[model samples]
Target: MLDLTSMKINDNNDNNDNGWLELALSSNKDNVKNLIEIKDRLILAYKNYENIITEYTTNPIKSTFLQERELLKSFYEKAPKNLNRNLLEQRNEHLFEQCPFCGRPCKPSILDHFLPKDLWPEFCIFPNNLVSQCDKCSTKKWSHYYSDIDNSVKFIHPKFFNLLQYIGIQIEINFPSPESIKQPDFIITFTLPRGININDKKRLSLHIKYLDIKTHIREYITENYLYWLRVSEQKRYYVPDSLNQRIKESYTGGNNNRWDVALYLAMINNDFIINHFDSIEIKKEIQDHSDIKLEILTEE
Candidate 1:
């Protein structure tokens, strides 16, 4: 199972141009309209911030610009809370990571409609629908939402999803693969659906399409499959004691649990041990042993 050691708060890089809040405040509409206005404002402010960062690299900034930076920072410090504090904080932190889709290493200044907000305004503010992305990937996948929303909801949220519920990680001794050695790779067949009925399926599909979970899976495979395979071969003859100890040390060092998953998958797929270990059985065992549970509401 994937272990979440601790969640760390990222550095505050909030730029204080409260144009979005201003838009929300100025909106004459009711609650939903106000929410939409606020959403738009957030998007615009992010875009503006992105532009500022972009220009910083190429255009020399005047002393006045540096002064404005301090002003913006102060404004953000005192900005009123509008949404859930935890969620807002997480969103701000996510902005620091590169876009998962395109590998662009910058926080996007605009909200991407994984499923266009137009189609499912209900999820416009859902944290799962919001991911920090660069401009190029945002434009490329602009209208490309998921085809299966129901399936999408079943998928894990990178920020909030529990990896242990539907899937588990472990290093199997034997599996069939091109690499002669055993290693780990993530494996799972079950999908999630808390209770989405037929109608809900249609709606869920919208969310799924928006997030591009399928694309994520493919990307995961392409990126880690071979790397894990190589690891398996190198460590094949190594005793489990040493391997487990190494893993324990790495865990203590705060390596991501996804690394373990990669090792599990590689071990399973390698041809050296297919008959010895049942991949599915081992997977279920891992899930059962894990502490994480997937549920609709956030854990309190």
Candidate 2:
């Protein structure tokens, strides 16, 4: 996950300057002037929204312009591409190679509404309300912001918490019995930094659970193990050193919480894997019964 600390609604270009509000207002000719009255209020609400959502007990924040909800949501839904083009570009300028939501080494391709547009449509076009995320994560995290049971905010706001920098994830690989080396099972867990607040800790845990982050990491490792193993063998580099180089390269730029980086770090720390690198044989069964010397094409 990435910390989009620099991205916020107020910091972005005013939507009014781009005539987005005007374009959206054009359709509702009857209520145009009425809706225009709340334009500044909406902007102010978007700016101060994050501050009010400080704790689990805090009530869900909605537009104070309750009577204008339909007009605002309708305008947002029917907004033309040109209006969004600039805003989306501005948001993407700071996007990292990794998705902000999952940190899966893919640049974010879609803008996810932090609060579902169905429920809180006033902020539908708000820059702070839009989270840049990969398609898979966006699909998985679709419209999920708060817990249904407790009605608490679930996903940590990237712009506010900067939680990715505060929390670290660890990988634990568990090999099968000595008789079976077919596949190694693994677990992904979080390592919280000292002095993190209780609310943030809960938010982190809820984010991971809500997004199914651990399961996804585990599946990725299991599915891609042979591919990485084959690549390492072909390159003829020391496995530990290769892993170290990878971790160093990708784990730079203040993002040390990536799952792939965590995997490499875990392998580097495991004495069994490190010491047995040279002798670690690619068993035939594990290699789909193909000879190790033959070219093996594995999906990334």
Candidate 3:
């Protein structure tokens, strides 16, 4: 995940109420006697959108808060055009080359609502609340998360934390017998900075499962693991550190958030992989394989 700080909000056209942001912020409808009691609540919500939402928390109101404020459905309908033109198109950079949610090399064609607009319809068009993500992240995060049950933030909000920087993911491949090498179990585990609070940790773990991020990384890690296995073998298992260095340097040019970057780093530093890559038991998996070639693995 790219750090929220990596990209800047394009607020050049925003007015005092921050234009669309106000409509979402006012959706909570604090003390209004009736829907008729307050008018222009949308403007109020937009004006206070930034201050109302925090980096670590989201509203838990069950009855679509924005609907109580006004005809929120109308705003939801028009959000895409504005989000793309006003925010995405205005940006000088594409924000990220890969989806921050999955770390795949795909364009952020879909703008995802960090908080589902269904529950918090008010934020449907809120610039800060929307994220540029791929279909995988968008489809996977299909409102299964309900932070109100535990009062914990379910995932890292790009508006709040640079999760990609403070959090780390390591992939573990449970090798099978030479015959079952194709079906190895790939386990993804996470480690966070020591200073991170427990609440954040809970959400981070939830975020991984919520998006099925590890499962997504499963195939990539296995392929890369197999590819690296082949890389070491073709070189006749000559120099361990030299080959590890080559792999590490190749992925580092991308960024801290990339999956391959983390994968190569973990494999290179892992004592077991280093000592066992050249073993006859493991090399057999590569030597006997006919599915893909080592040269092509690097191409992917």
Candidate 4:
């Protein structure tokens, strides 16, 4: 949900420096030569990444080494930790604490093969082919690059696409009734800006759907909205500005695509919420910071 277009990882370890690969294949010397020979070919396929999305059929990056797929994948797994550690570390410098793919407030701990290593073993160690992602997003994604039914790309490539510039997340809150304000229904949605083409929009929508982004967003909003409401209620004077500032703080240190921040902004902007701000119920449990407030009393 954030733009990682500026992220440059493993710049020092390209085709020229196959030392990492060499080390990985040191034990098994037989395939080392074969892999090293195909280094240029593998890098070419990586450089042609953009075309792969559009033309999966004709792209030359398919799984060709059928018999050696496991061996190639093992090279990626067995590579010495220090060799490609930069790929993990540098991704944090640009993305900060946000996962580039989902904008979650966690460092992307796993290196997910943008093109699954199982399917395309040639690009197993290709730095450009790996994406830093959170556990849930990586597990959920699980080698699904495109839809089997339609043959379209399933999600936005964080490194390739400028996500925040083109797509924005919007929240629509629905109150049960004007008089009652126990909790509102938090609806999460995507808004494509003017410049994006229909095809890109379709892809983005599919990306959101496949990743279950809307559900994650709704859960985030629902869990945090009441806490924010409590904070706003605590500020007796200059409530609007204080509330807005509070909401902005949630996303200020990280990516702007935070769903909780969006939900709070939507609440503050809504006329009904602003007008009836005082009346909105802040549960006693929320105010006390613990849901279970009842103390067990023993009868004498």
* Clash count in backbone of candidate 2: 0
Summarize candidate 3's per-residue lDDT along 87-192 as a digit string, tens digits.
5452324656777666665567877677676766655566666778878888987665466675656666665566655556666655555554445566676666
- Model 3: runs farther than 4 Å from truth? 6-39, 55-59, 62-84, 87-93, 102-105, 178-181, 223-257, 265-300
On a 0 to 1 TM-score scale, where does candidate 3 land against the true structure? Answer: 0.64
- Could you tell me the lDDT of residue 112 within candidate 3? 68
The residue-by-residue lDDT of candidate 1 on 27-144, one tens digit each, is 3433434344345544543434333322311331222223233322222233335533433565565434444443222465554544344433333433344555556556656643
Give the Cα lDDT of each candidate: 0.39, 0.67, 0.59, 0.65
The top-ranked prediction according to TM-score is: 2
lDDT value for candidate 1? 0.39
lDDT by residue (tens digit), candidate 2, 1-300: 666876654553554564445454544456567667888877676666676555655657664655666776655555555655655675576447877776677677786777777667667666667777877678777766667675667767776667765667788877776533337778777787788888767777787777777777787776666566666556545567767788778877766678778888777776666545655444423654564577789999
lDDT of 4 by residue, 134-201 (tens): 87788878867767665577777776677544556788888988865547877677776577776677
Clashing pairs in 4: none
If candidate 3 were superposed on the true structure by all CA atoms, what would the RMSD be? 9.9
lDDT of 2 at 190: 78
Candidate 2: TM-score?
Answer: 0.75
